[model samples]
Target: MQPLACRSCGNTVLVAKSSLAHTSVQWADSSRCVEFALAGSLTERAVVSGCTALRASIEDAVRAGRIEVPAE
Candidate 1:
């Protein structure tokens, strides 16, 4: 189990690997409802670093002309 901050209420919540694969994210403080699921291939550290890596990939694809962003 690991203590992860709730994305909703920012409370420190202990989550077991089993729970990450099953139930929805329930905030200890009950602020927001967040739906969650753990990818089988993701490690805890990979999860922590996910957004940064995802953003970098998106940006790189755009810069490389692989992804086209339509004008707003």
Candidate 2:
């Protein structure tokens, strides 16, 4: 899986066809994450900001070598 850097959200959210059950508040594992979509009930900017923070956290995990995600 090719990691994608979201320019608008500044996140590397995993892109796949999946359901909410397979995802989480924090997608530490790319293999488990599906693509991000803006729900009709939410604003685009809010999602973008949240995703930015999420990406930063994931980056932090990588820097600390604490993430144990399997190879995709």
Candidate 3:
């Protein structure tokens, strides 16, 4: 497991590959409430960075008119 800094609280939290697939994000504690499961070699930093980058890329694409923004 690897420690990842939370974007909202800046707290270093562990994010396992198993949790990414099965865990549910909680807003109360801002952390995972499950145990880690063995899987592919992915560090917490890598997962967080990938998630952040993906979100940014999607946002950028939407802003640049490369993607459509859905109306609420």
Candidate topping lDDT: 2
Better of 1 and 3 by lDDT: 1
Q: If ranked by lDDT, best first, what sequence of candidates would result? A: 2, 1, 3
Residue lDDT tens for model 3, 10-70: 5444432332123222223323312121223345423442334333444454456544434
Candidate 2 segments whose C-alpha is farther than 4 A from its true place: 1-50, 69-72
**In order, how many clashes per candidate?**
0, 0, 0
C-alpha positional error of residue 39 in candidate 2 after TM-score superposition, expressed in Å: 6.9
* Global lDDT of each candidate: 0.36, 0.42, 0.36
Tens digits of per-residue lDDT for model 2 on 1-72? Answer: 224454445545443323322223434433322233533333543464345445555555544544434444
* TM agreement with the true structure for every prediction: 0.30, 0.30, 0.31
The superposed Cα distance between candidate 3 and the true structure at residue 71, in angstroms, equals 2.5
Residue runs of model 3 more than 4 Å from their true location after superposition: 1-50
User: The CA-based lDDT of model 1 is what?
Assistant: 0.36
